[model samples]
Target chain A: MTRAKKTWPALVALVALVLAACGGNGATETPETPETQAPETTAEPFVFGMILVGPQDDRGWSQAHFEGGKYVEEKMGAQMIVIDKVNPADRPDTSVEQVVDQMVEQGAQLIFATSDDMKDGILAAAKAYPDVPMIWSSGDSAWDIGKAYAGLPNLGNIMGQMEYGKMMAGCAAALKTETGSIGYLGPLINDETRRLTNSAYLGARYCYENYRGLNPDDLTFSVNWIGFWFNIPGVTLDPTQVTNDFFDGGADVVISGIDTTEALVRAGQRSAAGEKVWAVPYDYRGACAEAPEVCLGVPYFNWGPSYLEVARSVADGTFEATFQWVGPDWSDINNPDTSAIGFEFGEGLGDARADLEDFIAGLASGEIDLWVGPLNYQDGTPFLAAGEKATDLQIWYMPQLLEGMIGASSAE
Target chain B: MKRALRAVPAVWSVLAALVVSVGLLALAGAPPFEALVLVLDGAVGDGGRMADTLMSWVPLTLASAGLVVTFVAGLWNIGVEGQVIAGAIGATWAARTIPGDGLVVIPAALAVGVVAGAVWALAAGVLKTRGGVNEIFGGLGLGFVAQSVATYLIIGPWKRAGIASTSGTEPFREEVWLPTVGGTRLSPVAVLLAVAVIFLVWALLRGTRFGLRLKAVGANPASARLLGVPTEATVLRAFALGGGLAGLAGAVLATGIQHKLVPAIAGGRGFLAILVVLLAAYRIVWVAPIALFFAILSVGSAQLQLRLDLDSSIGGVLQGILVLFVILIGGWQALYRRGEP
Candidate 1:
């Protein structure tokens, strides 16, 4: 027994030494952070914090926001303090306040809480740090005239006018569909999603009548919400199954509004297998690269210009509490340095591409307006009087899907 | 001398884990000394950080304190996570549906949490004793079901107005939240809850005949039955008692920390408690300090990422290795003793 005890200590020392050597290797394999908060002697880079709700490379909304931060870094010699996957599902133990504390400790000057899901946490955090300028992207908490106004002086909102982008997606689906049926894969039931899906319906109805020279009444548009921005297996209805259901129901083109690209992948699979199908993915510009053959062009958010402007103002100490709902730079819609929204047409738009361009030109020139008069909501209530235009508030707080669409407007 | 001899393997286990940790820092190309300093500083660097560390300690200490009871009964209550979820659900129901305002709601909600957790665990206990199902498999299966139920409530019934997102239920009223220290997120009531639980568990295990009977059953259930111990009833009581403590931890998570019902509210702290108990060698006296050390690692991970530019998952890696080394040394000693006679 004494000999066994002696041998055990020797064996433990050997194993420990091997592990120590393994842990001591001089290699760094982690993804590169923009800049370290380590002390420096020269003029320090202007540091800012960004808390993202999903993975930074999710090829969707989070990726777009990440690229926007990278753009800010490029425009000004600034450093980014990025904390991704801050949602409850991913990092349940870590709260927004905890991450904000870390960011403040690292000497961040301005902070961006990018996601509608972070409304409560961002509000609490903004109040906690009264001097710091905090922007809650894709929220209406700072809109004084809005329904959910909190009136916090240091808190503000920044959101791209994704309404125009959705209109473009709807127009593309309308121009390309041969089955006269279109499917929309919505994320959830909210004012933001409701307005976007309603805008898509109006654009599709306008294009199917004028561009496609078809009876708009015969065109079918249906939307299905998957209860979240992305699939979480058992917790959510599988996006893959929903996309297939759309295609099997004879919808040749399906538009996606969620952060990820399930609709495009399934449509691509169906098209490759000799089915006439197409998809319009949302959020990221490079999402078409997933299945370009079946993509009907993507309507994406270009958050770079706004993020750059905010960074510059914050650096110059000229930042203020403002609700910035920026629109596309009509002069150059696809300009990375100018536009807040842009739609890049895919290769599958063989003959309808030119008509789609004409439709976009009409929208930019204000010759065609889809949000105009004589419209009814999904419940057949008068939405806008004849020849009347939609006010920003009216367009923003959209209560339901439009009359032509087939979907549950509100969860109730 | 005997006490010194008893501490030998623990000392060696900690030494091995420390050596491995330094090697890991070196592997990450980070200076080991500076990284260690950063983690230690970040964990308790200020009054606020100390509060955060203590807040993290609450759930872990309470869960492990409960684990001590189940372990003493020779029953692995893996369903602790499910019981926690059940407790949160029950607490949310009481907070939302209990009509009266803050004056009388908070304590009642916490009581509901304990009962919910106990009931959920007792059902699992019944499956083990009467239905011939192993607690491990039964507990695990029930855990999945509980998670699904939570997700359903968050997205379906308890979702925010006009929104079906799986973020969480609406935040509780400020008056209903656990009162915290001035200007900080630390709740003194939550800390007291954890301390009181540990004291109660230690007292119940050391000063009662029930504790003796539990030890007898744990050592040999067949022989314990012949000695006139009602084994099934004792097992059920252990399950209920263990689950009640887990339930309280869940209630603290909901009322004190989250202030709402979130799908992932348990935060995997239930699993972390299992590790803490294993590291303490199932000793009731050792649970608190070991849990505090783990809490420091958890709260300091954000700092590790910021200062050393290392991934925060390294903290989890360190935790797993520490437990692995302790168990290895413990099992080796057990094998040596068996060989002696």
Candidate 2:
């Protein structure tokens, strides 16, 4: 028995050695063949690679980016390679840098790292591969503001004027809310999140006072930050619970700032259950289709034009890395033909459809200014002097909740 | 000769698994040989990648070492995952609430994590012993409870300001950040702690009377009772010891690697540790190397996606095949021994 036991260890060692030898042989033979597979066709079309933080069909954040890639593919004739669902939480073993490296090896000249969570990874890849131009979505790393920000020559950041979208969403909520209460289903507190929430609140308050002719003091705009972009059971608050809490707490309208359609879907269910609840979903154009019965409208991003412009500039060798925060074209704010921000009205808007359109027209014509304020922050600090309009920088770094909004600015 | 004869089946089983995996790659329309090369290259191609592999290896090895104790005691502590999260929760609480320098904060947080993990595991132990519940079911259920508690804290009380987010507590003060080696994932102190844990576990299992008595209880409870061995106390002790180590792993993961809590802070490492223990054949001596191998497979598989455009699930497939083969070979060996007798 002792001899047999000893023999097994030896046999195990032999097997390991043999396996290693086979693997070594395979490794040595691989590099040569892949290089030959590259097509000799005239300066291979700028292979633009995109890394999405969630699934392409998620119908929210990631889907918007995926559609942008498809747009570039169709309009610019760019070769697009997109890898979706690249979340750090899901793939702990893989890093963003490693994914970028793979894309670079696959002949991608330009890479778009989509999702705010990808900031660090995108920056690292930009530093590692200076020759490849990279664009990071919803990042401010390229801006010359903080010491942490770097001016990478090949790295640029692109984000839409989503505050405007949130503002419109807020207006829609205000026009639809029967209980004079609006619930903002927020995701994680950041400058971006706070600004969006505040914008929505401002929009809701504007319409409540001006359009609906209701006392602004009688309106309640509350935000419940679910602590993440989406529900991750046990690590973040369940969106359904937050939605239920909002509705149960007497909010008639819930505006979603999250990547998923939980708020809209939950509102739809509540409506089916005979509760008069309406929702405004954010991100993708098709988000309202999830539950048109309760979705008042959706404030969606039109990333196609912006993405195509960048890709074309790169292809023509006229690309300059810059922080681009594109806003809607005022002439046609909801024009799918030209505008970067488009508001699609859902079927849930019973009689508020025309009113909502009038509000949008007023907003586009500079007849409405949401930021014109003597606004106080959550701490009752003066956020804006009387009649002072916030600049892009001021709005981007919004510090706290606006006055009269009920919820903790920071986690308790 | 006997050892070699015994190893023969395991070697054959491994070879068979590899053959099966190659066939799978072919079915998926990938060049199996090239894919193998890419995995190896990605795993160990450079210093940075090696650091990442070792970074993953630490927590996995620590968790698997803990699992070995429970397996030896014949308890399926599937709640190890929850224990790890509980440990992270304890550690994050300390890091966030405690006002101290790294020296004071690191040890204090880690200690709390260990205690929290032990306490959590003890619940499963109590359920098994007193409530007549199977440890697997009890552990699994408790694991879910632990996850909910973590989520609640993150979203409710511990959430970062201006944005309650799954991003976890605004990263612990930089002063308390685990001292890493020049920005690489490798933390000297964390690695040393893991090695120290492995040694301690090994010594406990192989070089002590407690180990022998526990083995006796596991081998035959009735025989152990006849021999005046306190089986229940030994089993409970095993659960605590194993839980303590898993908690320490959670502390290391939180303070060392992640630097902040995410919902996926444990990242299924606790569950993966079960596979590590299995690959080591439940032997404490074999746990570290086996864990490292799995880490390599994990770290290297990213290249499969990059180089060959193969799905990352291929790595999971390879790991599953390896474990399946080992179990099959082990069963075959057992049957052979019975036949010979």
Candidate 3:
């Protein structure tokens, strides 16, 4: 009996561990039949995986990607397996390769690793699964002509030219700011982030001079970067607090360049308290809904059209590794089906809305050239000689911030 | 006979945990059986999934091995997490600064990691003996300090070139990584090290004079001192031993797993090791298998999220309840024994 008693507990513990499935009890109504592929018909559905860097409902960057995934499902009749909040602060040690392995095993025909932070993991996974087609958003790995090309035959890249959108955001801020100052809530310091911040400054400078009838040099544009894409409580400086600081420091308008909508949300809260301030949220078209009254507008990426093409190509067995930097459709920037980038005016655009539209029209018709010369780097080095237009390389690999911007050009 | 019978309460606790957990799952609205199948399939259903499980097992077993020494000394060295971080920092420093490639880098960097971890743990040991600070609080405070130091290095000095972000340092040079088996991420060296630590821990705690002294000091510090056992020294040594092991785990995380020094480098594996040690009833014999079990649950729970749309945290809740039930039943057994006496 004594020996039996000793053996019993060990056996029981093992059995309990191997058998206690945690809980799929309440998940009966769950729509997560991975093998069934959501449609039990004879025809097979194209299954793709989307690994997101933040919450799907974050109302910003990841949400835009999530909507893009949904668009693929709607248009191509594909099934998507999405996992979000793939960051250390959220679930530490869950590697992108591990997630990719699971997705591929479950028959993901293509994988979309969406987030600049996912660059390393996606590349590693691409090498591991050489047969699976992969799209890495906001990555330069597939740009054979660029410096960071990985030459992975299975990997391609897709990124919207959000520079134009940032310019629009800057233009609105320039037209609306009564204080002659615009604060940009930036996300990290890299070539990509630097270029976006510089783009916003250029738009602000152009509008503050020509459209608003003020000296572009007189507009004070300060860029403050919080180390990562989104706030991670202890690890990152709070975006809300940073937005408040911008308002408190006499900047009447703050434009966000991060993955979340803290700027517009904070501005709306402050506006509710009678503060005359506004914010421009980035990444998602519907971001203005958070604080429509205080939101000047939002500069967003529409990933749908690009994602749809990838899905179709993969399904039709005509996919090849390529790098695409999609831009807004000049015909109608708000056309959901065609435009890769957009800027939707908010209720807070108020009387300056028409001016912002005219500026947009000018950009569309090639009448306004923001990247044209006489521009200087932040450190006073000449970026463009007189009347010299920036080449694709100069714009894409912006090593420093522009002149007249108050921020660190590089990490050092 | 009595020793054999002592295992009865553990068995009943497992049974009770199973029942209560199944009930909880039912209340959660998930069909318990399907969820179990989901996690089981996710865990070791194939060679690849099994490899992932073993990868998680490496750091876990290492941390648990270290904790065994501390537990034997009756020390709650909660700063094991920080020691892990210190190890990672030390290894990262070697990866970046150590010049010449292949021949000497891996073992040399790991040796540095072990030293860094040992030194970090000794600080808590010194505090407990010299400053009248409890090991728990001192360890926790130091852990926070270590975390802050790591964050500073990542975002400030060791950050990626031209990138001011806390994502992590640049990936280690190709030579810095611990070699893996042919195609998978599994490192045979990491697994062997963990196995060696288990044997080392078993031998050191049960077969040596120092082990006897540690037990004496743990049982009664004054009594051990009266018996001329050098209680404080033994305690400090116990802490160093544990912290050294934890530092090795950190090295594995850096060189073997992450290949970079991330801010959350320890990945809370230190805390999970605490659970493994506890569930093992502080017995060294159970530590390895129990650590593997927990690793399986963790790796498999991802399947729960993917297949059933259930939160991965469901696995965490089950582990917590299992531990709780074991403690509760053991308490009841103790009370029953008291009544019998």
Candidate 4:
């Protein structure tokens, strides 16, 4: 028995010794390749890495980013290596820095970390791999005044002017709502989401007053923040519940700000159950198709142009870190030809298309300013002085819901 | 001769698992040897990476060390994950509500966490003893409830302003933040506490009469009861003690690493602790080292995807294979013993 016990301890010791030796040997032998390489003037395909927090085909935020990646792949003939469903919640064992290291080791000269939550991870990796160009999506952390901003020479931030798209969606929702009630299905109440929701409310109010010939005061716009980008059951209120609650509370139009098709799907089901409900979906181009019968339209992001531009710059050795927030092309706001923010009207909209188009034209001509002075925050505090147009910085950090909206600006 | 013979099967099983993993890696279009090298390098390649591994190891060791006690008492504390979550929730509540600095806040939060976790586990124990429910089912159900409760709190009353996020509660006040060693994630005090708990558990199981009585109940409860042992009390005590340790791990996770109560704060480490206990063959002495090894594997294998273009799932696959091999070898030994007797 004594011999057996002694031998077991020795065997464990040997295993430990072997593991330590392997680890030590690996540290010495592994080459520390520079993450960034100078752009070569060859026709060789540039390998780039794209990291996504959710599945590529989630049909929401992640799907849009994946489509952007695909666009770069097709246009530039670049080799695309993607790692999807990389949520900190689901995979706590892995760090974003480690994933970036993996991408660097695989010879990716540039990487796109495409989630707001991935900002810290991407920043850490940017510092670790100083040569590799890192681009983060929907984040201003690389900007000069951003809260988490760092002056990393190799890091940049890019996001579309989605507020305008959201405004258009709000217009469509207002034109379709017979009850003068619009439900904004908001996903978390960050500055980004708050700004988008406020933009949508402004558009809805504008359309209701001008086209619908209704008192804007009578038009009710209520927002319910779901506390996350998507429903996590008991962790966050189910988007389905919020959607249904909106409809149950007499909202004829439910506008989704989340990353899923739940709003449209639920609206479609309610519509089929003999209710006259309308829905607007966000993110991907095909989101309206999830419930086309109830779909009003989609304000989708065309990430292709932005991603293509960044990749081409890197390939041409002209890449510089900048916070780029591209807006819609005025002449062709919904044009696949020019705009980063495109609005696709769904089949559910009956006879409101021409009016919607006129509204868009007015927006493009700058004849109707949504940021005009007379706006008060939800707390009844003046948000914009008379004749004052909101600056990009002001819009980016919008802190409260505007007047004429009913809902908590912050979660309870 | 018998010990040598037993070791052979375990060694063969492990080799078999490795060979299988290598084949799987090849199928995934990665060079197996290179991938292995990347994992090794990523895990302990430098001081920073080793610290990261240790950061993960501390909480895991604490939880698994607790599991060793539960497993020794023949209890499957599947609810340890829930206990961990409950602990975090309790700690987060205290951290948010209690007004103080790190010294005062940390201890108070951890104390609540221990009590909450113990109570949560004891509910499962009570169900088993009083309501004729299996601990596995009861514990699993309670775990789901605990998660739901956490989710509700995070998204509702406890949510951060201007952004109710799954990102978790807004970070605790800086003054209340656990002290770290040199800006690394490793909390020196947390590490010392974990080591202390491990030693305490080791002493409790190895040198105490209570430990012997618990073992007697676990070995043959009916016989132990007939011999005047208080089976129910011993079982309940084991559950509470195990739960308290798991809770402390949760508090450490919240106060040390996460700094906020994320929905995935436990990060499935509760279940991972079960695997650690099994790998150590339910021996308390082996739990810490084995937990450290698993932590290294998890932290290091994260690099495989970057280096070899392999999936991060490979880490999970490797852990699963090891557990499967160990269990198979154990089962084989048990069958051999039955045949010999």
Candidate 5:
């Protein structure tokens, strides 16, 4: 009787173990049907992966890319695997390192690392697993050679020229600055922020020196580095505080170099409260709607054409690893098939919109260069000569705060 | 044999919960199996990932081991996270200003981290034991305050001169780097040092007269006080020691993994350490494996994110659920229920 009782419990325990194992196994099998069915209906086997810096719903930086990824998916009928909010501080390549591995293992042919910080990891991954094609956004020179180089035939970088939009934004800010004193909320004092600030300053300086006959020093400028890309509580880069400081220092026109729509919203609030602050936003796209009344204009990067062209090239196998630029002629307002730099001039433009449009036309036609001489950084250092346009390298790595900005040059 | 058989249900439940939680995450648009696979690969998959996992474990284990001493003494040093940040900041400042040989630099950096961590913890200890403030609130408030100080240092006068974006201490030289093991980033010295810390903690809690008195104070402070034990002082000392260990972990993180101090150097590990303590039931020896388990979960979350396209937050959710289930299922001393009682 005792033996029988022990046998019964043992048999029950074995059954229970089998059930638990089956329950776990059931989850793994869930995707099998869909994964098989997906290939049958689509008739295409191409799987592309994207690693994002933030959540898709962020409605800003990462959101723009997410929308682009979706666009590619729709146009190419491709399969996509997206990883979002990949914290850079967590590991070397963020979450892309593992995501790419999985995508490759699952037979994904192409992988896209959507942020500049992802460049190193993507390159490392590309070299380690050469069969996968890796696309990196915002990397300056992967096509060129360096010790950190991961020489994979399938890897390349894609970027847009938003500087033209920045210049237009500066034009709006310069024209509207009642104090002739505008503040810029710059995230990092990198080459990108430098040129964007410089372009804004160049346009502002052009208006102030030519139109208003004001001395450069009289147009005070302060630039504050938030020391990071986003507001991490207990860390640096609180845009709210920085914007408040700019307003406090008599900056009536505030331009943002940071990628978020936060500064524009804050400017709207400040304006509503009778502060009369105007904001010029960058990485444009939907930024005009962020605070249309207070938002003067937004310098947007049009990624549509570039994304379309890249997708077709990958399909055709004609894609080469080159540092390609999508600018001006390829991107302007009319071209539906190429990337371009342009901004949405807001309702507050009043009568200036027509004139601004004309100026943009002239800029597009190369009649004017914003950096034409007598330009100086905030510290009175000359950056451009009369009748000279800044080179790609100059624009790429522009250092120093431009004159008349309200903020520090750098953080630790 | 029967006693061992009884433990199977508890172990099986934990496994079941982990599997279910991971499946839920996969359903939320992640590849569940791949994520779990990658997590395994990252945590113990190979030498490289294992080293990385171990690298993360050093500070965690060190903090966990230290917490055991204070936990046994019945003082909850919830402020270990702040202490860790404080230690990192202190060590960073010392490493920056003090010039020395590589050997001296490591010790100096460590000392700076330890001292800073201890001092931050002691403040809470003093308030709790003497000022009669609850240790929980005292530690919580001070943690917030310490974070602010770290912010001021990074953003204000101490901000690195030219580098823009990212508030961080200046990077230390390669010479100042802690020694590593066998071509991996796992700092051998840190491991050795951690092992020593574990032993010291085990000895202090289980061996010495001080350990006995501390347990007495923890068990019944009033009774221990009546027995002429300086219960308050002992508790304060434990608090200070615990804080120092957390701080040391922070310092190690700054020096070892990151090489420069960023505000996020602690990375919520301090809070996780408390979970480790509870899961181990404050047992000195149980902390290691529990910490490793949590580390695997973390590493695994990253894997799931990559392989399955799941969000990294999913790992945290799964861990939270598992811990919650364990607590609920454990059900307050049910394991030790007696027929007489």
Candidate 6:
């Protein structure tokens, strides 16, 4: 028995030594520099790695961010390392540490966590790896909107004004609705989606009160939280069915708050079947190009400029932590850089184009406050008192479903 | 004693395959060695980390130990995943509805969880014994159905009110949470409980007459039944015991790691438990160490990702490779003696 124990220790040592040697060989195999040496050009390739919450093929939330990563790689010749399909359900708390460490070891000077779920992990990693710059998408207001990032110095956030796009959708709906009724397809009843839907409603209300001269009672807004951003197989609210439910309730125009545009495709099918319905797409531009005839416009986010700015800061060594919020300048329809809401008037909206321009200009000037007071819940309880504008905090965390929304607060 | 000692080298040979798999991951631009170290550290290097590792071990041990019983009865209970999920749901439901004394609450929660898990497992048992369906497919199909049910509750009926987030049940109150070892998430009571469970199983498998009958039935069910052993009943009981243990494990996990029920509370621990049982060769004592090793791999993988700048999932890949290598090398050494004349 003693001899057997002795044999086992020797075997263990032998295995350990073999593993150590293999590890040593692995480090040596890592390439130091390329063989092709250009004498004059001095710009070293800066590696920037990204951790995505979903697969790039998700074609919605993750894919939009991936396109931004690719844009940086193509434009500035930045070496991009991307890790995808991270399970959000598990303890993703350590994922940031793992990604940051991996990326930094691979000579990445900057890392990006492209999901809201990655916020805490990214924040912790930001403090731990201060030398390596970190950026997160759709994070807390403290990170960007306030002076919180000033202390951190190495963290930054980039987000578009999604509310502007919703407004444009609402504007289009108000102009087109013969019944003066509109339906909104929302993924979750969170502050972000609520604010957007509210803005859409306000815009619709503004156009009806100012342009169409219809009573506020005639307009209806319906919301269904798909329970999640996307439908899990064999579970969750079906987005297509939800949209059909809204259309069945006599809603001519539907504004989507969900990630993917399958709802838009469903709307296109309805239009093809002679239902006379319209859809306003979110997240990406020219997505409505597939159904231009019934497509009202695209309320798109310009993540390109923001992405370039963030990457360039890393390259120039003058990057500071700040929340960068870029919105529409409202002058012309030509420049894609300035506008958060890309207004593409439908084939049927030839005469109404002038009216949309005026509304867009007014929104840019802040002449209309979307969350002004005198708002009532569907049960007629006052949400906002008369003449009371919602505070930024209240706007950021809008809890209750607004009046005229078609669906319940939660799925159940 | 000598034969037991000899198994160590064979085990290492199997583990060497795991090392090679890590190396392969390194080739894909990940740091396997560092990740491996992190996994080790995460499993047991310090008190806090050990506490976390032990916390992970509780559910794993419970399910794996139960699997040994099913294996002994010649039944593969693959539906432990679904059973665990069902158990969590039942436990969560009980925790919400059943108002009781503080002492009784936890025990009641565990009982509810175990019963739910057993019921899920027995569905497979009934299908196999009565409908003549294979336990493997029946268990797997039941597991899927259970997952859908959990998903339904999380996304639809059981979702927390006033929150517009994704599908998930309401979080458990602090009062309902199990007592932890000191302030850390690790429960001393859980460890003691698990030890008691192991002892009970060890006794059942080794010292009892039923144990011998189970072994005989597993070895040759037709012959055992011919010799007056009730094969179908033994198989069904084994499944119930297995499912009950797995359900208890699910309750522990829900009340421990997640602190709430979500659609993904099981997190594939049920399926991984199968590997744990196989690696231990269905030995209860061996499970304690092997499960710890797997947990360490998971923890160390993060460190490896940081240190080597490699993908963190290299640990999972290494785990698969380790199991594969162990089986291959163990088979080769068992069948064809290496370094022998």
**DockQ, ranked from best to worst:** 1, 3, 4, 2, 5, 6
Residue A166's lDDT within candidate 6 is 75
The 10-residue segment with the lowest total lDDT in model 3 chain B: B3-12
- Chain B alone vs. reference chain B, TM-score for every model: 0.95, 0.93, 0.94, 0.94, 0.91, 0.90
Q: Per-residue CA lDDT of candidate 1, range A1-412, in tens?
A: 5535654564454334334322321122445443453344377888888887766666788889988988877777677788776766555556788888889888988899998878879989998999888889999888889998888887888999888889889999999999999999988788999999998888898899999789998999999988778775556678889999988999999999888888999988888899999999999999899899999898998988998888788888888778889999998899999999899989888889998889889989999988899999888999999999999999999888888899888765
Best by TM-score: 3
Q: What is the per-residue lDDT of model 5 for residues B1-341, given as tens digits with 9 covering 90 to 100?
A: 85554443345446867778767856665556766677777577767567777777788888888778887887767677788888888788777777986698888998999999999999999998789998878887888887777767766656555445454655677677787777656788888878889889889888898899889988879999999999888987888789889889978987777666666667667766776776566776778877787777765556665454444455555665665555544443244442224
Off by over 4 Å in 3: A1-41, B1-30, B100-103, B311-341
Q: What is the C-alpha lDDT of each candidate?
A: 0.81, 0.79, 0.84, 0.79, 0.69, 0.69
Mark the 10 consecutive residues where model 6 chain A has the least summed lDDT. A28-37
Could you tell me which 10 consecutive residues in candidate 2 chain B have the lowest summed lDDT? B5-14
* Displacement of the residue B172 alpha carbon in candidate 2, Å: 5.5
Clashes of each: 3, 23, 8, 2, 25, 15
Per-residue alpha-carbon lDDT of model 6 for A192-304, expressed as tens digits? 66777787887888777777777766787666667666654334478889889878988888777777776677789998999888877676665676577777776766565
Cα lDDT for residue A298, candidate 1? 89
lDDT per residue (tens digit) for residues A253-342 in model 4 = 999999888999999999999999999999988998888988998999888888889999998899988898988888876665367888
Give the per-residue lDDT of model 5 (tens digit) for A1-412: 3433443343344333323322221121112111211334437656777777655445456766766766676666766667666653433223355557656766677777777545545765777676666778776545464222444578877777767777777777777788877888877665556767777776776656655567755776667767665555556558888888888888887788765767888888988888888887767477768788988877776665666567677778877666655575623653434555557777766666776676677677777677566566667788776667676766666667665565555543
What RMSD, rounded to one decimal, does every model reach? 5.3, 7.5, 5.4, 7.8, 8.7, 9.7
Q: How many angstroms is residue A298 displaced in model 4 relative to the true structure, after the best TM-score fit? A: 1.9
Per-residue lDDT over B1-341 for candidate 2, one digit per residue giving the tens place of the 0 to 100 score:
96566445445656877899889888778899888777777777777677788888888888888888988877778788888888888888888889979999999988988888888888999999999899878887888888778777766687665555566666677777778786466788878988998898888889898888778877777899799989889889988988888888888888877766666777777777875675565677678877787788878876665566565456766766775676567557755765685
Encode model 4's per-residue lDDT on B1-341: one tens digit a residue: 96566445545665777888788778766778888777778888866677778878888888888777877887767788899999989989989999968789989998988888888889998999889898878887998898888877876788766666776777788666678776455678888988898899888888898888878876778999999989899889988988888888888888877777888788778877876676676677677777887788878876665555454456766766675666566556655665663
Greater TM-score among 3 and 4 belongs to 3
Q: Please give the RMSD of candidate 4 to the true structure.
A: 7.8
**Fnat per candidate:** 0.33, 0.42, 0.31, 0.43, 0.29, 0.25
Model 2: DockQ score: 0.25
TM-score of the candidate numbered 3?
Answer: 0.90
Query: Which scores higher on DockQ, 3 or 4?
Result: 3
In model 5, the Cα lDDT at residue B276 comes to 71
Candidate 4, residue B178: Cα displacement in angstroms equals 5.9
